[model samples]
Target: MAPTIHCVRHAQGVHNLCTANHVIPDPLLTDLGHEQCAKLREVFPYHDKIDLVTASPLRRTIYTALESFEPVFQAHPEFKLIALPDLQETSDVPCDTGSEPQALQQEFAGKNVDLDMVHEGWNSKTGRYAPINSALRERARAARRWLKARPEKEIVMVTHGGFLHYFTEDWEDHSQYQGTGWSNTEFRSYTFSDEDHNADLEGHAVDGDNATLVETAESRQRRGKVGPTPDRAQQKTLYQLGTQSWNQQLSTEEQDSAKVPEGEEVNGVRV
Candidate 1:
């Protein structure tokens, strides 16, 4: 079966060169960002299986998708890059509030979408549609099921960090959600996964690390970790659980390290 879509965020861009009200920043990836993409390719050595690539239309996301995957896709028969407007960053609020008018608002505006807490106010008091995100998620869930229907393929989507963290469901908050994006050349491949694969990982905290978590449908419905798992900060990195390419390259160590089998998938998460 194919993995759910990869859903990656774009590389870093100039945060302060310029900013303006209603203006989006058009920064490119930085040197450090390039290094990070290289690290991503090395860590996920089996990147050629991606059947398709998609991205938000923003320059950072488009450039990131092209720079990171072109090497792997050169030999791919069905690979092509597409765009999804739904994956764009949260709309920038206007500059009507004169909080910081030292200069043009353009310089500092890009920073707003960097990395903030996930949108929790689904039903804000304003009764107006709160962008504490919802529709984006509904669309992604639909997208995930649609992709999984295809067999033997992987999908890559490069977008902004906000969509990656707050909207993409399979991640289970496993994403580092660090303030910065990958270096211009660096990229990471996230397995589009179902909740069942992680049933064994829940309530299983590694040291003070409350952030790195997994979930299954039944348990997630019953004992949702209300906000942070309410623990001390411990160190942990994102780790893969499974993939077709991974199975082929399964060293004894890797076979042993995988958290679950290939057939397992959370039906509740399946549309």
Candidate 2:
């Protein structure tokens, strides 16, 4: 099997939270914010396998990485840092970009006038709780390319808490509410492999055994990677169904709504 790819959300920031009143803004992790990441740095195989390093375009995530990955750079100065916009926090907290604060709850479709009960239907720009699924999948696809170029090796992504929360919790089934919020410092791995021969220069296979797999808890725990995974099958399944329903509704909405011209450009970027 190819090495495992680990996705870590940065430790809690001062601004790291969901708002009961409205969308959270500008809170960053405290001194202990990056402390968990710092401790994690001592455990993972950053020195052994990690071939690529990327982060969300957010400071919390970036700062968390600086502390955790000090050893990685000292060993490989040539490794470059890439910032992915898609991997950024979705609630639209504006920092210096001057955009107004986009409430995380308002992001959902049917936000009750009351602050607490956010509906899955009316939750995001995409109107899906699992937009993070799209983001994570894109990262995986990008991983295929990175692996092809680097040759069979692990790729580590240092990212945000919400993204990791959705990925491990609701991804396979699609759920609106994230099952669990992430701990300040958590290391989760999703492994990818290729079975088909249309292999890239790096070695990704296309067909058999080509599908990605998750490593076992025993294996991971044995390695002293991290912990706290209880059996979460039922909750995950229910959320998955809800996610599927919302996606179907969104598809219908898109079909009904008139779209811009195929050739149309918005700010030098096409829709």
Candidate 3:
């Protein structure tokens, strides 16, 4: 079987809470983001199945991986942490601009991040730091190719929301959200084509048609958040079925409403 790539959006960053005219360069995670990272240990169902843990070079993503997968690292010391600059957040944004490799190593020396694979000054933009959609697309493509070349069968990456949409090419899934981006600590799974010939010289294009998105525990948790919104028809149906099993007295109308309703809001609102 082909490897399963698990892309994880980093926990909330200070910049996410407050964006200034000057993008805060390589911001750290907010307290809420740290809380979310801690919850990932409980929410990530594939803890035992993961073969490796990789992350963007940015402080937020690196910290997310360190916090979220602490147990995995303890159990499987062989799975070293790799800091991939190619997988770093889009460079056009100020917050996404990473620190120098030496500085990062100095700042995060206690972490088990392997900086050898990262290119020198990989996240530094040459001209100006401004969010450019096209540039981000190209960077995502490069990151995809790099990930495809990895030997591990199951991999996890902690990265940024701005780059994830382009990386996964699943804009429709997140487009409805306020920022059209994923929530903090959101983890998604995708299965790529096993045949390397399917990718062009630039590797897989932004076309996600070839990839299959699988639902994870994190996604389910997002959907189950209690709010004023209408209940999901699937959840409602399952509840009715359970009632029938326990009380043996569900009404026909109740049973009929179990079917998933048309145009139901999904992939919206953060939990």
Best by lDDT: 3
Please, what is the whole-model Cα lDDT of each candidate in the order they appear?
0.41, 0.46, 0.63
User: Which regions of candidate 1 fall more than 4 Å away from where they truly are?
Assistant: 2-4, 16-24, 93-132, 150-152, 170-271
- Candidate 1 CA-lDDT value: 0.41
**TM-score leaderboard ranking:** 3, 2, 1
Candidate 2 Cα deviation (angstroms), residue 198: 18
Q: TM-score of each candidate?
A: 0.47, 0.53, 0.69
Candidate 1 TM-score over all chains jointly: 0.47
* Stretches of candidate 2 exceeding 4 Å from the true structure: 1-3, 17-27, 93-152, 165-181, 193-213, 217-238, 241-271
Over 4 Å off, model 3: 127-134, 194-271
Residues 124-201, candidate 3: write the lDDT tens digits: 654222234445545666677667667888889888765675566554334333233477787877666443333322
lDDT for model 2 = 0.46
Clashes per candidate (backbone, < 3 Å): 17, 21, 0
How well does candidate 3 score on lDDT at residue 116?
Answer: 82
- For residue 163, model 3's alpha carbon misses the true position, in angstroms, by 0.6
Ranking of candidates on lDDT, top first: 3, 2, 1
Q: What 10-residue stretch in candidate 1 is worst by lDDT?
A: 262-271
